[model samples]
Target: MNYAYLSSLFRKQTGKSITAYKNELLIEQAIDIFKKSNKNITEVSNKLGFSNPYYFSRVFKRVTGVSPSVYLSQIYRN
Candidate 1:
């Protein structure tokens, strides 16, 4: 891999850069799976390679301002 050349390719037009973009992607996908899956927290965490459910819940809540179960409940009621 040409590290320098690839690095230049990912220098975001908005100045956020590639790492930030990838993080946004991860957080976005997490929400997608959370809403779509009937899987439990541990399953979501494991599926997403989050190491543990506690940390997964923490990150999910941080991004969406609610627990995964709570989030799922809202969707289910609608």
Candidate 2:
């Protein structure tokens, strides 16, 4: 239940650190919320606890290979 043990177990199973996994999960959830809601990037960023939309867009693109606006456009096109 401790931090070290949990991080070890998480890394063993996922081959990534807990922080990386959590950030990935956050991006995935952000994608879902963006696609399903009418909120703009700044609103979505705020809702997800990001201090600013620019930082959120950076993390989103880093994790998913697309900016939030681009991702939303792609989803809408398909």
TM-score for each of the candidates: 0.64, 0.80
Cα lDDT tens digits, model 2, 1-78, are 899999999899999998888779988888888778788899888888888999999989989988988988888899
* Candidate 1 least-lDDT 10 residues: 12-21
Checking candidate 1 for backbone clashes, the offending pairs are: none
TM-score result, candidate 1: 0.64
lDDT of each: 0.75, 0.88
lDDT of 2 at 31: 80
In Å, residue 21's CA in model 2 sits off its true spot by 0.9
Q: Which parts of model 2 have CA positions greater than 4 angstroms off?
A: 1-5
Over all chains combined, what TM-score does candidate 2 have? 0.80
Q: Which candidate is the best by lDDT?
A: 2
Cα-based lDDT at residue 29, candidate 2: 81
Position 72, candidate 1: lDDT: 79
How well does candidate 2 score on lDDT at residue 30? 88
